[model samples]
Target: MDKKSELRRDLVSGDWIVISESRSKRKHQFAKKEKRIIVPRSSCPFEDPQRSGNKLPILIYPEIGKWRVQVLENKYPAFKDVKGCAYIFKKGPYSVAEAVGHHDLVLTRDHNKRFDQLPLAEAELVFRAFKDRYEMHLNDPCVSYVSIFHNWGPKAGASIYHPHYQMIAIPVVPPDVEHSLDGSVRFFEKNKKCVHCVMIKEEIKEKNRIVFQNKNAVAFAPFVSKEPFELRIFPKKHIPYFEETSEAVLKDVIKALYFSLKKIAKNMKDPDLNFFIHTAPIKNKKKYHHYHWHIEVIPKTNIDAGFELSTGIEINTVDPDEAAKILKKN
Candidate 1:
């Protein structure tokens, strides 16, 4: 079967991913690469953001009358303001589009106290800022999606010694979100049930994969362990958008997130990890009630090798069942 820009189902999860034959990556040989050195804290640009010529912050939080975290435009942004209509330039068959989106960093008062170590209230405050900024960007005509994510430790892509999260709002629906949205739409069309809500119900029944749960949210190891110790936290209700998430649900989510991350921190001896929010596109949210939002945490346990990279399939060294056992024990 051929799909021009249609949704295709996955035999494994019975989910769907958009495969636009007309607009897709043409297979090519791998390019040459080089190793690079990590920047030291002393020379890290974010350590002294102002001195490094970063733009004035759009938002700032203070503690002890000093800067805790500030939301500033990325100094060397992937996206920047351009002339009318965010233009795209082309080089041969390749297309280069202006990253005409917003990239902001959320810094906590501490360069150390990793998110899991922060006071629950402080963590909640960080989330409050996340929601605030997300809403701000949602109104921007240029943005289609806003991604809020945290990279902890070196393994998870944190180049600096400091703990911070990033929010990037862009004009396009990212590939991951594209796949998830398609999945939920197909599920809803077929079963008339939300995919995530169904998964949560099944998880509750199996009593496996569950890491934690409270009145409003649930945390569990995903059925598909793209990487070992991967976890997804979701609101019990079938909320289509993250910005619409209630304050009460946010509090419980933070608790569940804190507990789950703390457990992984203990289990992996503080491995680096990347955690991010996955939700429906901000603009088309009304068309996505079946798209329940969630956070997925993938620990950087193993490096992506040749096969994993070439095929786009991640191989986990440890199994989910075993990972759950170890995390739960910790």
Candidate 2:
């Protein structure tokens, strides 16, 4: 594309997104206008997890008599723990493998308390659960990567209204992760430095795109934001493994995360969003030492229209600097 239709390459994934200034709309116009579809508490499956036919929680943290947060196997999982090792077999010209892995849900007790609304202590507990589950799945011989993510509203792929997070351990590294790993490796080989760390330094120096930061963690609107108000949170120290992070550092990271989400809710008019952890793959820790683990929070501001779907190039209307300015407001 031409300069007016700027194609920015993602530093980690190396994917190009077209920022078409020609097709740009007002930043405020991207705010969500739809009403959230609230599922009743009585019919919510996560209200009483066991009574809803869910298997007993693998891990439960009880506060008094009631559970504060619990980790349980998903009732309907996308991937299941099969008997044997996951194998790649040929179906004529195509190759496929059995989806042999683990899918679990980390659920909070309160139905109405979103991550941004949760108390700081409770939010920290949620990350503690994430680290616990991530470490648990990393031990599996068949697993290559574990993905921890949360979907907020229906548009962001939340089928249930109860606030919950999901962890999926897969036998192979996903394409997006593969691309990111490749990009990081290439950058490290050429520059001998972590790309994300470099970005963090630059963002800190610039201070224009910073949303929030503490001693241990920083959150900012990425320079190459794929969507409007795309915020990324990173620990100041370059750690490739999320599970290895300490509770104090994790609390700092979650604090930045909560701050980002709260700002997004207020600035974007409560848009649906998806936040996920991007860390080094479980099987190749040494190879990804130069990589940095972080969380990317993407607000569902626009749907994939014809151009985006055809070219894999997202069109972000709002500038990252503008987004940061808006989010920084009280």
Candidate 3:
């Protein structure tokens, strides 16, 4: 086989990565992960959800009958249910804020339909709900960043057998996101281009890693993916804010995302995965014109162990080229 390698830049953090083909596994040795053991459908809490003792919906879409999607306060929440600003508590030299942000669970009608299994139309509706609830949380003056994500299996942190997504709005921007936004700003001041758009253009030109593309969006396993089967989806257009995107673009992006997830599931055999959107901050949308919004999907296959945690870096066990080969088959 020919020698292979790829140089990739982080859109938000402006970090360069090298995907070395020397680290790759052989094609015949590419093993598939087993699908997760789901909770029995009978014991599935989401089915006939009301009998399961879930609370009243905070925001309901249809406003009648069994809801497809319902926003509810998390029962055991990391962030307090009471809405309030972060309060600084002094503990010696260190200061910390009260975990006093909003935590909500967005539930869909399906008990068995994983996000990847959903029809594109249903998946788009889930994303629309995400944006809607994000705006609602921002109405509170304390909210700075909202995280929307899905956890597919136990290792990925999903406790229930039923399909659901989560959103947490915090008073402070997450540190990783902070570094990313700072990097984007720095890149803008220097090179004067959205880092994500630059990657998209290059990936489309190469077409080696691109798994799927629609009119408005494209999905690919990143050249420097931190995990085997990691995928990222970006709008072909330079979209600064997710909420600000037109309905047409949003729908297309969701389709691209849904299909990308499906391909991952089919090829990787239902590896537990998590995905979230990374975008500019709520305060300085104008200042982040150089930034672009995209989704990152990380499938949990390897444990971080000592090497990764100590080094503050990840080792991708399956080469991205192999990952793309697996993911592209669907």
Q: What is the C-alpha lDDT profile of model 2 across 1-330, one tens digit per residue?
A: 432566788876777876665676766777788887788899999999999999999888863578999999998999997887799999999999999999999999999988999988899889988887787876688999999999999989998999999999999998877888889889999999999999999999999999999999999998888887899999999998888888788889999999889999898888899999999999866778988899999998778889888888888776688789999989
Error of 1 at 80 (Å): 1.6
- Taking all chains together, the TM-score of candidate 2 against the true structure is 0.95
**How would you encode candidate 3's per-residue C-alpha lDDT over 1-330 as one tens digit per residue?**
765666665665655555555665664344454556768779887676557777777777668875777788787788885645788888999998888887888888887898867766677778878988888865677787888899988889999979989998887888988887888778777888877777899899989899889999999988768777789999899988888888888888888888888887777777788999987767655877877888989877667768667765566656676788878884
Candidate 3: 10-residue stretch with minimal lDDT: 26-35
- Candidate 1 vs candidate 3, TM-score winner: 3
lDDT of each: 0.74, 0.88, 0.79
- In model 3, the clashing pairs are none
- Quote each prediction's TM-score: 0.83, 0.95, 0.92
Q: Which residues of candidate 3, in runs, are more than 4 Å off?
A: 2-32
For TM-score, the strongest prediction is 2
**Best by lDDT, which number?**
2
Better of 2 and 3 by lDDT: 2
